[model samples]
Target: MDYIDSICNASASILDMTPAVRKPEEGKVVLDYILDNCAKWPNKIFLTQPMGGDEVLNVTFSEFLSESKKMAAYIESLNLPAPSQIAIMSKNCVWWLMADLAIMMSGHCAVPIYPTLTAETVKYTLEHSESKLLFVGKLDTHPWNEMKKGIPAGMSCVSFPICPSDVSYDKWADLIGDNEEIKEIKKRTPEEMATIIYTSGSTGVPKGVMLSFKNLTDTTFGLINTTHATENDRYLSYLPISHGMERWVGECLPFITGLHVFYAESLTTFVQDLNRCQPTLFLSVPRLWTKFQLGVFKKMPPEKLQKLLKIPFISYLVKKKLLKALGLNHVRYAGSGSAPLPPDLLAWYRSLGLELLEGYGMTENFNYSHMSKPGGGRVGYVGEPSEGVEQRIAADGEIQVKSPGMMMGYFKNEEATKETMTEDGWLRTGDKGELDDAGRLKITGRTKEIFKTSKGKYVAPAPIENQYISNIRIELACVGGRGHQAANAILMLSEDAKKEAAESGGKDAIEKELEELIKTVNSGLDDHEKLQFVAVVNDVWEPENGFLTPTNKIKRARIEEEYNPLMEEWYNSKKKVIWHKW
Candidate 1:
């Protein structure tokens, strides 16, 4: 069977499955949503914190409300300003949400810092945001020790109930202990600042995007309309809640949808946690999706699985078994965003009965822009502009958006803000995209990432890289040939691929396989866009290594800078593919 064509035909007839449009309640903030839900379903499990060994800690809606109120009362007792700026640097946990709610209910703006950031960047965010108080939650002891040194001497610090060892600070428990529940929560206007989220700093210094209560509420409603999530829906919170996309969907969406949110205990236990929660809504970035694909290939070789899947009866069983093994059988809605998801990956999942949708958004807009419609699965396009979102392709090909969910602007960066917006008030998305006949948005590449070759032809690397990354063996691919004859690629092998190479015919066989892969990819590209040489690097691209942003996007400029010096040497060697020596 021609699965691709079959799937496309099936998808063409799939109608939009979203629920009827229900306008968001007027003049209500996220806190109000939580409070209302608590009143409506006091005993509903609001959050589940997974503990290793099959143990879990669940918090009911009423308990969450009460604890948050007590924490808010304690925050008010500190006598801080009405709109104090507080920072939370932690991984996803129950305490993180508690601190976030407390900060908001206390009429303070929350500044979320990615726990994976370097100490220098962490300090920069703390100092740049001018945060008055810092809530230290789940973090690595060594990094926290290093980061704490940079905190201002007089800044108040509070530690979550469970924190890194040897960290001496005010405990969150002390703040809530024996404290009277705050009878009245501070009322915040829809336009008031709710949080200042720092970007992942892939290219340069992270900018603080100031999102208002209106932005959050608008995005929450927009997502609800798109995904049709319900109170009974379960969501696994594994992605860093610090990310605006995750914050809006994984964290804030629950407040309005009344979804039961589960926290992944750690990376090692993610698969187990996923099985335990059986989340109906699963949101992940491209990298994790790629990793999940790799995990599947590891269990069953691609050739064998493909052959087996050709049998109609076997295909159903195969997909069911595979999805169950991956703990994704119950995922009613699965989405990939933050970075581009390869079309092949999307189709592959669709073939297995999981419709993985592509979404597009940025922190500036609180992540409400475009998403693939429930059943309108246009393969490469991130479906039509979301309800109430206006989008256009500029003459330069940049995608621009006008939405109610747009951030107020980058905090304290008026000049930068002015540069990001057009005279007509549309926010510059920096992404180059095209709209299909059906009005689905297909992102071509980043405007800044397009590079010119010596022949004066411009090359967009993302599409080219996507083809190479579809191969499970390749973990990352960076295509560059600025001022050169043709583009070259830097390939990072997946751990399983590396192990296979070592166990099989070693580097020689790996190079041969990669050359064939490159040839296959090049056949689909234009003459100016074809790669001349491919360089394989043994290093892993990770957030800690500064090669990837917290959201798992590659730092292209940084990668180019690190490898540009070796380009000429690799080219002069006359090898079709060269392995870079450290």
Candidate 2:
């Protein structure tokens, strides 16, 4: 029997489940699209970057192109070698995109570093990639202070106008003003390298994935086709541009469609920025989606909101008011990715009239993979294989994919690249999944993340962890107990849930609710997979604390290392729920 047949409905043929790898159509590259947009809509607003309250600077397409060309000329004047690597370290902003365009125009590849990385990791990436120059832009004080130490002294540096005032560098405005705009655009072949994206892994050193111009163009066209993207669409760019999804959807897609892009000022002003943009398409990770829901619950209690939603006329108005306040009333398409969203949460958003969909992808493929169809999505599955994407499950149950936008290789790491790719050219996804009757893909867990208990039965933690977080009281969870009789879950409470615990009788109510939740969750699991107890940890796991990645995915290895030693003690407590301190 075939792998697809093993999991999918008997009537669904294997050929229907796996499509042939599609070749990219010969066409103009992303740079060509930008040039075309400039010629077509020279005076149209291209980027809206916020400053302080009620103040935003909007740049027209002509202005953007002219400034980028000037920056390119300035870069050329430095006499750097062709195909040099230029690094940009900043939060999402307009100048960040401009620096990227300048790098492209200057006939170089860009290396974007996450703004939240530690000094040591930052130094490692820059040194490993051998970046020739660095562009520093919009960042907070503490992060800049920490990240600056990683920059190699005497390295050529340029500063965007909105950068921290503590350090002096050649200013973007002054440099572009001093230089002449290059009259000719740099011509690039489709096969030429475009960028080196370093994966911010949950464990170990980050690997730089090399992608070509054709790879990006192929992925962009696939995205445009599936999403029905148009020039009238609006996008709010808040995620790190260094990430693959943001780079593809937020940065690359806009060039092709001339869509207006808005930059979020800061976390403090995200809601205000969202209101200003009122984006048509929105994408976020599960953590943020949960936070958004919790934000709503903070205003009106969930019980009251549910009761109000049951009324006919009042339900319509309540939904409208809530969605409008969240700045999602205009969102025609919404998506969740990077991690699994609890099904109830997904249902919650859909119930409110937002078309929230789930997607699946990784950095290696430029995130051009599966996405739920507008109205064809299942609760727990990411939609079927995208056009030109081929997927197959190996005998070991790992999902391997071949896509048009697959990376060329890892930068300066042939061994790792070779290990990741199969001889037939498919990229190993490292994820275990199953195909359903409707061809949706349900990711079970990471193959490497599965742990065997003392009874010798392997346990996949993802589904169980999902069960824990589905109860709104828990914000994040990790399930483990590799050598124990049964697994255990460590939980972090949501801010509001914690606040509730501080009030009279609130802690007892939460405790009772959690005890019931664990019982209900355990009833559905295999005996060996059932959790012995759940510990409510006193501290929250965050990126700064080294417990989570910058993207909010837990660093499992770190979590296990910190907690596995005390597993016996936790098990000895003999309580269904335990309050733990580390």
lDDT: which candidate is best?
A: 2
Give the Cα-based TM-score of candidate 1 against the true structure. Answer: 0.95
Backbone clashes, candidate 1: 0
Candidate 1, 95-178: lDDT as tens digits = 899889888888899999887777788889999999989998887665567667667777889998767867678998888888
Q: Would you list the clashing residue pairs of candidate 1?
A: none
lDDT of 2 by residue, 1-582 (tens): 001100111112522444344333466688888888999999999999998888899999999988898998898888789999999998888888788888888899999998878898889989999999999998888878888999998989999989998869889999998678976668877899999999876868999999999888888878776666678889999877888878888889898888999999988898999999998878777778898998998898889999998999999999999989989888766787667888899788877877567778888988877877766778888888888899898999999999977999999999999988999999998889999988889899888889999999999999999988888899999999888888999999988888887789987888899999999999999999999999888787986566887777888988888887778888988888887762
TM-score per candidate, chains pooled: 0.95, 0.94
RMSD vs true structure, all candidates: 3.6, 5.1
What candidate 1 gets wrong by more than 4 Å, as runs, is 1-18, 141-146
